[model samples]
Target chain A: MNGTLEISGLSKSYREPVLDHLDLTIDDGVFALLGPNGAGKTTLVSILTTLVLPDSGYARIGGVDVVTSPREARRLFAATGQETTLDDLLTGRENLVMLGRLLGLGRGATRRADALLEQFDLAPAGRRTVATYSGGMRRRLDLAASLLTQPAVLFLDEPTTGLDPVSRNRVWDDIRALAETGTTVFLTTQTLDEAEALADRIAVLRAGRLVADGTAEELIAAVGGQRLVLLDSERNEVRSIDTDGTAASLAHAMSSLHAHEQGLHVALRSPSLDDAFIALTQTHQEVAA
Target chain B: MTALAPDRPSSAHGVGPWRSSGVFIGRSLRHSLRDGEGMLMAVALPVILLLLFTYVFGGAIIADGYVDFVVPGVILTCAGYGAASVAVSVNRDITLGAMRRFRTLPIVSATVLAGHVVASVLRNLVATMIVILVALAIGFRPSATVLEWFGALGLVAMWILAITALFACIGLVSGSVEAANGYGFILLFLPYLSSAFVPIETMPAWLQPIATHQPMGPLVEAIRALLTGAGEAPALVSLAWSCGIIALSMVLITLALPRSKDR
Candidate 1:
């Protein structure tokens, strides 16, 4: 129940640094590492999951070092990688059963397999080979296989990367449900809304470093309140001005002719994770440079 | 976190010591069985080669007793070739994300390689039996006693196990399933180069020494001797080669398994 993931001063590089001395600690709940492509989200998950080693520092799952004591750390979590690990030749149920047995489930493997199949709404397809299943079904079954042993933590690396919207929501519900049982869920994603919706705490990673870490509200607040924008015909912003959502600020802002232009598109926008990400990382990169 | 000790089984649910191997081996065997085309090819390739050699090339190359002489080579070659397919299977698993999940699990991941090797050996045994039965139908005969028959079977199984392990290592290090297939094909041709098909003496003079020196030559020669009662068993040398290959493959597998996802 005390499941927590902690990584400190962790770094890894192939040609260039993929993860640069990154540090973060996450308690039991839904924690998301949000980043764009090539921001080292997968690399960090690999290191934390013990699939890849770091050049230096340490990563731990439930206080067990993933690098120094990977086998021990492995006990605390099951990872559903970007690629679904389900065997295409095997049935969905068989895939779960195999993992169950491998995790030492014995005869109980079948029971667990059935339970997971039903839980993931895969019982109907459980007998069908994975090769015959839809992409979403395979992703769901992949999640089911990971939960066969019911480890304390679950690591989802881009779990819904190629999923349909409906499937993505189903997986999101599953992650949420697992965390409700006091199981820690560590996830990585590029979708801002996914992190804002699912993660109790979110860490924004940019070029292998933590640019921002906070709740969704905190991140949005950090970016600023709201924006008034004058856009060109292409919807590209021509002039942007920040303003409080209050009518007084809007009235005062509209009073300026410098902000008004003929045939200009006018739009009021609320700050989102995208704005925060850009603002946070833009400043961090500038400072670093 | 770095100071923690190895935890009690996340899998205290494991029934016994053999559970890991049992589960993985079953998984592997089931995979082999389900691949109907692959399974068919495993059995048919050897038999087809046997027929082609015994009828087409056997009479032209030898002045009689050709069927008897070629049967041993075909049986061993079929099994070796079948076992070498482990490289393709193993590489598929690696490329398909099976290994990525395995590494993150609580089980001894090395059992994955064991599973492939064991399954290949078992599957090859079945294919070898069918090949021999076909040989008998085609006037091929072996003069071995019951003890020698068992010895021949065991030798073939050992050779399969060793090559399967070696190919499994090849699978682990290979970047792609196609690449693994290409590498395994290199070893597959060894049977043709060595005495597995024709006697080494029939080869060009310069090529004879190379054929005689390769492991397949000693191994096939040993099995041929046991099957035909043609000469003394030089099986100790074949056994040594099998053990060495298995040992070296095991070490390479361990080294490669952990680093598979790194690249």
Candidate 2:
């Protein structure tokens, strides 16, 4: 019954239904919430982080009910909201130290702040105010602040939404490092690439309801198998074959193609996570529509 | 690297409300000190008005003892108007997601407001002193007992507490920092129209009632009485105004704070 995160009958509505009796369970590792814009990703994160409340049902983190005992539950998780929730006037080091102290680190707060600054490769800019730092630096500082207490469950709400590719990769590396240490990171992203790259388990949400939940490969397989393409040099055209990831289908297609042509090319096109996500969302949209 | 291991939050211990408040208060104070133009305006505006009114308008406005009469009024004006910056500060925090971040933490919710209140009160105290010292340097002398001086200080403290709470609430409900600044100016203008700068009787008949009956008039009169070693009536009236403002603002702030979410 106890998991890293558990939600049941969790429903919330404002004007229209934002979350409709959504249920989810996660064991550990990086679990990503994949949805398009207005799919209630941020709203779910808001409720989990205790910044907002659900109208009905409840959510639990590590066996503590977030609605009934938010203060106790707050101890188990740290969140970096969609926006950069930082005191921009304060220097980066000061902001981290302040968070550390608030998390009950006491004198060790300074040491931790210093270490985090260096680890984030922001040691030179640590002394500068966050207002002066670039967007990527601010995101790194926000992440650093959230990790001040090294929370058991970390909620990152689109942590790299607006970052450049280089900065995004840097944040991705830090996220991986945190997971390697056994911190369960629950992230939400509209970008399928982000989810495919980082998530151990991916949940596709459509219109406030979960449409699919599985590993990347499983979802991809369920949606559709990969394609096998055969090119004939003389005709200057390509022929296609389908594979259910079986050696028999590939061998049969290859044998038929090889007997006919002197010059032939063959390739296998595996279904990408993007294909799975699109298929899942389109299926849900058609049903809802 | 393993160096990251040492930076973790030691043991997941929680912070007490008072400790969290102290940290926030320290941050608020640091912010105010670093804000050069705002700090200068908050501290120096009253002193400037005191000198300007005492020398420029003193002879024409008063028959005698102009400096002594206007100094208390100037101080009261400063006390009443000091909340503009507090409004800006509080509004900035709310609108910029600082308070949102704080709410997600394990610290007590009241701690954020407490820090703002403490910082506003301390800044008022220092600004009041600067105004008083400026009054002294300009040859304004009051023949009051030490106890009367203490009374003046106490009344000023209460006055600051009331106005800061009121303006902070205004800032909280305001749509933006610019709107909060506009509200703050309205508060700053109130004292000027009251007995803070001139006698209520000297105003036009229609405005006289407002000038005399509003909170600032009583507060200024009370401080003037204390400084001049006059009677207790003004002090009593001032205390009533201070308490009324504090109570009303507290109710308004409580009502408005809930609606400020996501703003």
Candidate 3:
């Protein structure tokens, strides 16, 4: 199928293997690449951004080969990395202007800078040097700088890892807005909540290869079964139930218990994205073992 | 919070590569201007050296003439100092992630380095002018023609480029700003030990050969040759050394740049 991002047999290793023969496809909208630490999410982002070279395989953004014509491929993408990349020597506005100029904005760079500052709520501190900016402000400024180019595809590599909930939500809103404008966003995050909130399609990666790829609902269905269970406790209390296995049997058991009016608390287990994630990963580990 | 709206199209004017690079260079220049203490050091260090050598040590050391002798030394000192300042700036940018941001842009990497080099050249020229004015005020005069003055200035600019390239490479390889500063100070001091500050012959016999062949030694000799019309071959020697060092450093830096695999 035609995709906004197409990767095949991609491999990269630094000393030890980071991304092993991995393949995946992402179309428009926010696609979240989720993995735990050292899963090569950042490595993949770096390669896709033309900042690092992969040892093997190829990636195409909007059908432009990233390795072959990096400059042209870069035109299709912008990235905000985990570390803040704002120039501390310049003011927030000046940093944006520099980015705009580098992106070929010319005299219009200043206008764009001002607009970005306003959009990112940096207008109040636009004149202040970035050295004085707080962590959240710097991150916001960094994100604003990346958007100055307005690439067809944007990469946010763990954009909200260290942010407070409010700041994270702010970034999430900005990301959602970008997607609403039909900008393809490829974000990598260790936070499952972030993935659930922003990603229309989620791909779970382990040791560089995609272990699972689907919408949250699709993944949940694939894992199978919704179970409702109860455990006996003292004083006619109900305890936890394991929701792994057949849904019909669990529901029937729950219904029977309810019919009896036994003093019980009910716990229902439908396969969630988290459960799918755990099952897929554990199965892979068991096979490897 | 305001909505995260994409910018509206306000103009159709797009910048070409040359204009964009110019803006980058101009912005860097403006940053240096705003740093008053930095500007002072760039102008003051060479002037201080010139005065100290010409007044305090001029009597003890014999040369063709005191002002002419000290002028070349001071000029080389200024150029060396200018290179160190560029190193500090570059190191700061690397540390602050400015270089990382620049690398992501569509602009060529060479342009960013070139912009910094141009700024260093310009700053060196200003520093040279300040030193000359101070020397003139203290009764130092060059009997050479305007063409010779221009030639001397060209040599100084070339020396600054060479030195700055070497130090910029150091900044690239440095692990931290503190390490860059320490190494830059060492590099700056190397020129002082050469003919730039004291006569090479005044040193121990074993050290004379090393001092005489140093990059700054020939630069000082060349500047002195042009300033007093002394006709020394030191300028030619300086030119060769400067070009070699610059070429070597640029190659190493380019190699280091691509090999940086930090995600």
Candidate 4:
């Protein structure tokens, strides 16, 4: 597939099955895995990043088997987990330099660290210990440390969960820049707007299984038509026509109906990505019921 | 874009994995040095204990001479304190997610543990020197030769390793930093209650037997033999006890280490 990630029959469970025979592939772009809380997204990331082992599934990164050659596979990837793993005792610069050294960079590790600090806009606060850093700064430093090796595949688990909108946008810009450099980005997030804004491809996971996977536009199209409404009698009381629940169809229905009423108020109810997501998942829930 | 470009250098002096391990070790040592409270405790506690014993309790306690009686005991006690520090530091690191971060890194798993252990040894050596200087200042003198002094230092270093390993294992099993601290204090306290502080003969008859056979007694007596040219047999007994503790603790720590899933 010429992809960075390939997983098959990836099953992992602690007492009960968390991921049930899950399969997924991520190619050379930013892919967002969207799921509700406790949908095993973190577990999947853990297994994929070699932080946790799956019971029966095999995973490969850049065509290297993660199980037998984890050291080799680890060289090609970096993961920023949901948990804050940065050592509080170390300065932000020290943390980056340590990671660089661990990744086999020698005397030039400090130079790389300085560059990363500057890139992340953390050069001013880089000398202060991480304990004194704000949550957003620590998050940025954690992201910077993970990039010390410049891994081909980067996994960010809920990177912007606690970030303000401005900080989140800044991180998103960094992620985009990384992807533009041919680095494959794998991220899981609960923010629909984030996924909509950044994801080249999106996969919806419910209860550890892939319910839907496609481009955002394709997924939106698959959810069906929109509703169109027109008020014929009064401003408050409106009579509707062609309420199919698709944006394009609703726009056509509204325009066609708008011509017929002289004093009528018309509106188009186009289905949004949020609406499509809720409708699709709710339908799946109903079928399961 | 050019700045972000990978700066692949020539392979003439390519750094290997072992060199990376050395860097990790150096990083850990730097962390220890910067830990203000830890550095204070590692340097100050042993010297305080030595001064308190020699000045406050030196006159009453006698087995040929006070320096002869107290030096061995203080060295062993300092080794015990060193062990406590190792346990506390290791436990704190684990609880703070430092060990977990190290596990996820591309470096060898054993490197982090090795770095901390070596740092602990070096810290203890410094503490030992301070204690010796303080003892000399207080009119205590060693009867042993220069070679014997070095031999004594070497034995105490080995003793620190054994004791530190045991406490490090305890720290691993401990659920929290507080628990590890408490456990380490208790481990160090055991040596004080044994013959390390006072003569076993001076204790109650029932307690005397337990005090003589305890780990600290043999280790302290061995240091005493080396420092004062008392005898070689006691040193052999001390070496045996130290080896036993080291072997047992290593096995326990190996088993106690968390698996990838647990982390």
Candidate 5:
């Protein structure tokens, strides 16, 4: 249970309940929370980061209760919000230095600012005002600022949503680097590729509730994998392999179809993470309906 | 792309408010100075108003001695312009999510607002000095002693601090920067309705009470007396008004600040 997150009966209501009585136990790793708009992804992240208060429930980060000891809980995590929050009027270097100072680095603030600027590849334009920076540069600067006070956990809300492919890759590398250092990352992203590429555990949220939680391979396998499709032209028969039906059953069904004809065509389509996500959410919708 | 190291310094330690406030205040001052349009509006508008009132309308309003009579009022009016800048800047920060970012940080939450308010006071003082210099250049004269001049500055500084706090509160309550400017107009126009540009005796009986009893009137009168050796400057009433505005502003700002859920 070390570096674990425990949430029990966490709920919030604004006009409508954005998060229901939810419970989860998350361990150290890159855990991606995937959901559609208004699925309470941001609301949940906000509450966990101590930016918003929950009506009821308990969320503990590294053994610190987020509600009762908010200040203490805040010290355990750093959040890079959905939007770029750097001061546009200040230069990139100034923003980092100021944040470093506020984080209690004191004399080390300047050195840390320089290191961050260099690491983020913003060294050349570090002196330029943030207002003049491109969107990608601003995103990088925002990420760099968040690293000023390295916390045990990092929350990135759609960190690379509007970024170009190269910038997105850069962010992906940074996130991987952070996780490699044993920092537990809670990321929310609309990009399925990002989730598949980095998430050790993925949770799908629908209607203010978690519909599925597992490793990518497990979820995809749970929905079944590699459907076998066959066409027997002579008898005009078709057969599909089901995971539950097993290899012997699938072979028997196919062989029965082939007994009546020699012109048989077969194709195996492996299920992807995208299939699992769609299937999980589709089931939630069916149940709700 | 350069490889980013996974190593980082831990940030669980707390930073004292005094150190954080110092950095925040410095940043605010730098921003205020760099804002060219704001600087022009704060410093130039008052100079233009002073020239217009002293040269164009001086003859029609009064035959002579208008310079000494109107100089203090012009200075106070300039301070009003500075208040508008404060309101706009504070409003921009709140709407832009900078305040939210600061709130999530480990530093003291109120330090950002305090920095902006203190910077506004400093800016207003600079603008007030510029207006006074311009007025003197354009034939305005005063007959005050060195000690009286210092006294006038202290009084004006206090008034500027109060007005800045009041406008900061207005900015917080306002929904947008444009709306904040609309709220600021109330303070900007207060000078015209007061005895700033003209004497209260010239106004109609109906407007005299308002023109005499308002905060701006007592402030202008107090500054005028100090600068020109006029008798009985209503210093007590002016001080009370300034203190009241500051107190009320603190309460309003506290209530209007952005909350965690609001962000």
Candidate 6:
């Protein structure tokens, strides 16, 4: 529970409901809160990060209530915001060391700053001011600053919203590497691909509430099972079949295609989360109606 | 890959409250020094005005000892100019991601504003001295005792602290850095219209009352008295105004700071 988050009946509203009595729990691992533009993804992160207070409900980070004791909860985590929260005028090393000093690290602050700069492969660029840094460098430096004081939980608010594919992959690798070390990462994303690519557990939020919560495969199954398209040597579709997406069912479906043609190729396509999101969102609306 | 590891906060083993304040103050000081243009303008504006008024406009005015009289006023204006940037810096911290990140940490976020104010005050004091030295070289002389000179310096410092805090409040409430800078410009113009350049009596009758009532007027009059060894210092009156501005700005900042962090 040291890196876990629990929320129950958490609600917040500005002009209207942004996050309605939403309840959620995240265990130790990479968890993604996937939602479109206004699904209260930020509101949730803001509340958890103590940027804003929720109207009603409680949220606990690693079992410490964020509302009642934000300072204690602060000690348990670090966050990287969407807007690149860095002092552009300061050198990367200065920024990191300043954060270390602010966090009360004393001389260790400088030592950690140097070590982090080298580790991020930014030792060469650490002497440069952030204003001169490229977008990728800025993000990497921002991440380095956040990790100055390692927290049990790490919150990344849309960690890669506007990065090129290569930079995005680098950040992804860094994130995945962090999760491998047993730090619970809670990230929010508008793109389902990012969620699926990074999160072990994905929760889709719609209009201030959660519509579905499960693994990628479970949400994929919710919309429809996997599709099997048998192709000939020319790569033209020879036969199409639907299966329940289970190991046995996929085996059966593949075997059925095996008897049809000797030179056929079999291609299996997993269900997309885009379809799963639409299906789940429509299901919630239908039930409400 | 484990670069950020074993990196947990050493809060328990490190600095006390005073050292924490030192780091924030040091950051703002660095920013003040790096902003070369602002610092230059703060020193240059007063020096430029002193020369212009002492030579350019001095022949037209019949007032005796104009340089001596105008130097104190110019120093007061110089402090105002130096304090102006505090608002812009404060606004940047609030509207940008810097203060947002700070709030998430274990430190009190209000210290950012305090750092700005203290750093601005120190920067302005230095600018004030440069202006004074420039005035002295250009035939400006005063007849104050050593203690009175100290009194004038202390009063000027208090006035700088007050104005700096006021600008900081402007920055806190401003929606953008440009807006804060604009407000600073408005503050810069206020000292010019006061008894800074010419005596309030020389102004049109209607404008005289407005100039006399402004915050800069009392401090200028008091400082002039202290330096010239002339009549009443009106030190109590200027102190009251400076204290009032400091108190009001502090109240507004205390009230505005928490809400500044909100959406």
lDDT, candidate 5, residue A253? 56
> What CAPRI class is candidate 3?
acceptable
* Candidate 4 per-residue C-alpha lDDT over A1-289 given as tens digits, one digit per residue, 9 for 90 to 100: 1337999999888877788899888877999998888888998888877778888878898897777776667777878878777877789999888777777777877988898899899998999889899778888888887777667788889998888888888888888877776668898998788888889999887777888888888777777565466666655686656456656765666566536556776566656788767876777778768
In model 2, the fraction of reference contacts reproduced equals 0.50
Q: Could you list the chain B TM-scores for each candidate?
A: 0.90, 0.91, 0.88, 0.87, 0.94, 0.91
What is the Å distance of residue A2 in model 3 from its true position? Answer: 9.7
Each prediction's TM-score versus the true structure:
0.91, 0.89, 0.86, 0.87, 0.91, 0.90
Candidate 6 residue A217 Cα shift, in angstroms, is: 1.3
DockQ for all models: 0.42, 0.37, 0.30, 0.27, 0.39, 0.34
Off by over 4 Å in 1: A231-267, B1-17, B259-263
Model 1, TM vs. native? 0.91
Q: Candidate 2 residues A1-289, lDDT tens each?
A: 1228999999988889999999998878999999999999988998888878898988999989888888888788889988898888789999999988888889999998898898899899999888899999999999988878767789999999999999999999999988876778999998988998999999999999999999888888788766788778878999877677678877766676657567877788987888788889998899989
Sorted on TM-score, best first, the list reads 5, 1, 6, 2, 4, 3
Model 1 lDDT, residue A151, Cα: 70
lDDT computed for candidate 6? 0.83
lDDT of 1 by residue, B1-263 (tens): 21111221243233333677788889989998998898798889889999999899988888788888888888878888888899998998889889888877766777787788888899989999999999999997788999999998988888898999999999988889889888766665778988777878889999998898788878788888999976667798889989999999988888887552465
Q: Worst 10-residue stretch by lDDT in candidate 3 chain B?
A: B6-15
RMSD for all candidates, in order, please: 4.3, 4.2, 4.4, 4.6, 4.0, 4.3
In terms of docking quality, how is candidate 4 classified? acceptable
lDDT, residue A65, candidate 5: 88
For model 4, what is the C-alpha lDDT against the true structure?
A: 0.76
Q: Per-residue lDDT of B33-120 in model 4, one digit per residue for the tens?
A: 7887877776677678777777778767863467667777776777677667767767876787667666656666556666667777
Among all windows of ten consecutive residues in candidate 5 chain B, which has the lowest summed lDDT? B1-10
